[model samples]
Target: MSDGLPMRVPAPGLPARVRIHEVGPRDGLQNEPGTVPTEVKAEFIRRLAGAGLGTVEATSFVHPKWVPQLADAERLYPLVSGLDVRLPVLVPNERGLERALALGAREVAVFASATESFSRANLNRTVDEALAMFEPVVARAKAEGLAVRGYLSMCFGDPWEGPVPLAQVVRVTRRLADLGCDELSLGDTIGVATPGHVTALLTALDEAGLPASRLAVHFHDTYGQALANTLAALQHGVTTVDASAGGLGGCPYAKSATGNLATEDLVWMLHGLGIETGVDLGRLTATSVWMAEELGRPSPSRTVRALSHKE
Candidate 1:
């Protein structure tokens, strides 16, 4: 592990290259107790792209009343719009989509939940109602020539309703896939998922005619299982993973939810397994460290701490 590099040992039954969907800029900063400065958010996105993250979620266009942290989406988008990497923003509805589209955005994502309680809590809509809401949004985005991603949260477990059924998750995700989302990002919102549970969900989706290649896994580290669950997804043929730099952000609405899988940690494991993610671990770790300083706290990522100290 010289110079913060992991020894490559290619694994069997794994994709040669995996895409890291960096979410720290948007999903990561939205949960901060205080709003991060717009300039800082812009710099973070640039640093992530510079670290070789091919796709970086830039910001969300939700109403400022809902997420004041990202209220500066309009001001923030312009600063990072010229970046060469893909910049995807989260759009909750047509208004959000309009705001993103006005800013020349080519990629947008819609966030949905798999459980009723979460749907009501997050979107004030039931599972069916939420999907109905997104139908037009996805269609409109696609019609406008934008790539759309569907984020299905609470796939594993929910705070109010314990342990979700596999069929329940599969059903919701299948609908999202049908909405013409280029990809579905399945979320373990409360971080209670185990490896077998991860395998079972992927299998169910496959049976439902939704293959793993069209899915991305978004795992939280509350139970310290994010990395293990991610490994299970990779073994199951999922190549796209959603991770936050410095392991920042949780479900602002889900009180029990925790920080997402750290990009630094995921890159370490992927590089170790000889998978290509086109990310520079040292630069990514340095970016997280810089962000930790801006947030006025040390990063929670072990790899960030380890590699950062060496630098």
Candidate 2:
């Protein structure tokens, strides 16, 4: 939206407000090679919400062996439990759910891959097997009065399989909806999606009985197309978008995958479109800059860099 291109009017029926589901803390830092101290992760979540992110993914309940960076979920969740934001944790299974419940988590997310290769590599199970494992986890979380979000990874393409069929994504989406997931996030994990691909997939899913309102688009910026794909999703009536602060995190199973779409970049586009996100772009940019400093690297977001230079 900010490449000096002409801005087209949003199609009719586009939502006036878009909810940004910030995944920087959980999905972003989980893959960092060096361990971020538990306290630092907690502070990062606080800063994200302070920047007006209403929903912040707090941490993952995956075993430390799998993602050693987030093994401190217990210690980290309590630190931000009192915040006025919705903090959701990623639960891998029923055990993960129990761990989250014990810590007073009000929201939890379950993940399943759209491609068999990703499922086998990331979860060590077939796609169906992974969904079967999450069935009870979703039910238990909902019963406990916690909001359950389901994530379908590799919705557009897969690193191992390549060009995943739209049917596969639709089937998995329906299954997740049937499993009682309150919302489903369709992830372009390997970042091969173009705007046309996004429009086609959303149209197919809508025809398959999955409403665009119940779906969020999660894209990586490996191909520099995340924002364009997001615009496509918005025109099709998607109201929730998942992004990471400082464009953090990538799929470990996706060797070609880069960082998730930056929250600051999304905010810039949303604000430019006259869409209300309740997020302060200046504060969000500052948070990402601080995070980049903490990570000992340059901020990956173009918006953040431009804003920093102006400052």
Candidate 3:
């Protein structure tokens, strides 16, 4: 056995401490064509909480024209507000921020894309313009005593704009950090990132004086590389990760983008590595299976599939 600092050997294992932010309720349902009823969304959140997830992306405050599924943010937030968890809502601009604050959102996430093409597609604005727009929202949210998390989407690659420059990622990250946001999440939006790319990017950030504690990694499993990328980040000392239950969600804008790294799959990897995710893998698996049945699709989590087969 190895001694001190829980190092991941060539063989598989869990990390020492792992924090999973469940995004199934928001990210998982956002891209689906059919609008999931608010009650169903609340039920998903309830199951996740019962499964021991501490942080959940509960909803988005975008207008109905953009993401009609989350138009019921106001309706859903109050229903689950009393839970013992952090419910982070994604706010697109000052209007979104105002709505979140009015509803008493404790924490919020502001998003920016590292690639110009994606920024244009997702936000209908350039990278710089989107950041400029969110500046006041971040300020106002902070003024309202809300915690802000910054999302840097397409950190690794963009469909229209090939590989994103590390410098661009750094610039966006710094901008968010300087704007008084609490944490920054680097998203492998299209799931094109590999282990080496993760290491390179994190290392560059470290070299640039950005500590890992204030950072999280959001990865998609499009190329089936999400777990590998998670391990790479764990080895580099990342403590927090973003995942969805049942491997739900895909980018409506990114044609090739797939669902996020499944929470069950990520928890399986973390538990194997001795990481404490405060999540029950068995319960999470059951939840994913149930969700798949609810969605009328096959479960996307490899770990869930394997466990179900064994039973």
Candidate 4:
């Protein structure tokens, strides 16, 4: 899709190395019932780093009232500061960015929805306005020497809107790219995307002139298509992915939504295919087990449940 590059499919093997951005610490805890204590959150990050994840989304800097679970972001940030891994936090606005900057965050992420209805409902703004909101935040983050990652949620389909246009997804991603975001994560937030849809979207993105190296894929398993869609993206040249440990988080606003693609499951598949994620399987499993115990519930990862049965 780029100039002079044949958009042909990749060979039938996984890449030698892949980067897993662990979102279990932040995205996983956002939907849980009780507020996970700062100590527990810090331990969670430590455990994830021990599992060999290079990048971990530590916490969100949103208002406490909006998400009470991550209210102690200030406390949590400093606790993970000494870790060797890249710690990124989600900053939704100027206030959130201020908090993150105070915490000495080296990386910050901002999100926008692809569909108009989802954008208005989730961010309380239209698509264009939501895009506009991140311009200043991206600028400020870059000014502070922080790497900015942008997320385009519901890139495949929206529950209320259904069947999003590829052109719209491309436009939003391009805008985010132009805003100086170092990486742009394309998210199937509701997990309604299939392999065909995934490939088609990547093709469209490639044609739209967005560099493949700057893109990452985030999928949910609502329809059990997360891994299949990921494989499709891999074949199309995606190296970074967003997955939650134990498949922990789902959007509270979407009644039909399910948890994200489990990190344990993704790592297992990558290992089986001879791909290197640099994650310790046993430690990753232990982290999921800890989260399950903290929440007093079963893990949503099929691989976790299956592996637990053997032990």
- For each candidate, the alpha-carbon lDDT, in order, equals 0.95, 0.91, 0.88, 0.88
Candidate 4 lDDT, tens digit per residue, 171-203?
999999999999999999888899999989899
TM-score of 4: 0.95
Model 3: residues >4 Å from true position, as ranges?
1-15
Candidate 1 segments whose C-alpha is farther than 4 A from its true place: none
Question: Which runs of model 4 end up more than 4 angstroms from their true locations?
Answer: 1-13
TM-score, ranked from best to worst: 1, 2, 4, 3
- Writing each residue's lDDT as its tens digit, candidate 3 over 162-226 gives 99889889888888888888999999999999999999999988888788888999999889999
Model 3 scores worst on lDDT over the 10 consecutive residues at 1-10
Q: Ten consecutive residues with minimal summed lDDT in candidate 1?
A: 249-258
Measured over all alpha carbons after superposition, the RMSD of each candidate to the real structure, in angstroms, is 0.8, 2.5, 3.8, 6.1
Between prediction 1 and prediction 2, the one with superior lDDT is: 1
Model 2, span 101-184: residue lDDT tens: 999999999999998998999999999999999999988888888999999999988887889999999999999999999999
Alpha-carbon deviation at 298 in model 1, angstroms: 0.2
Question: How well is each residue in 1-311 modelled by candidate 1, as lDDT tens digits?
Answer: 77798899998999999999999988999999999999999999999999999999999999999999999999999999999999999999999999999999999999999999999999999999999999999999999999999999999999999999999999999899899999999999989999999999999999999999899999999999999999999999999999999999998767777799999999999999999999999889999999999999999999999988885
TM-score of 1: 0.99
Q: Against the correct fold, how does model 3 do in TM-score?
A: 0.94
Please say which candidate is ahead in TM-score: 1 or 2.
Answer: 1
Quality of model 4 by C-alpha lDDT: 0.88
Q: Give the total clashing residue pairs for model 1.
A: 0
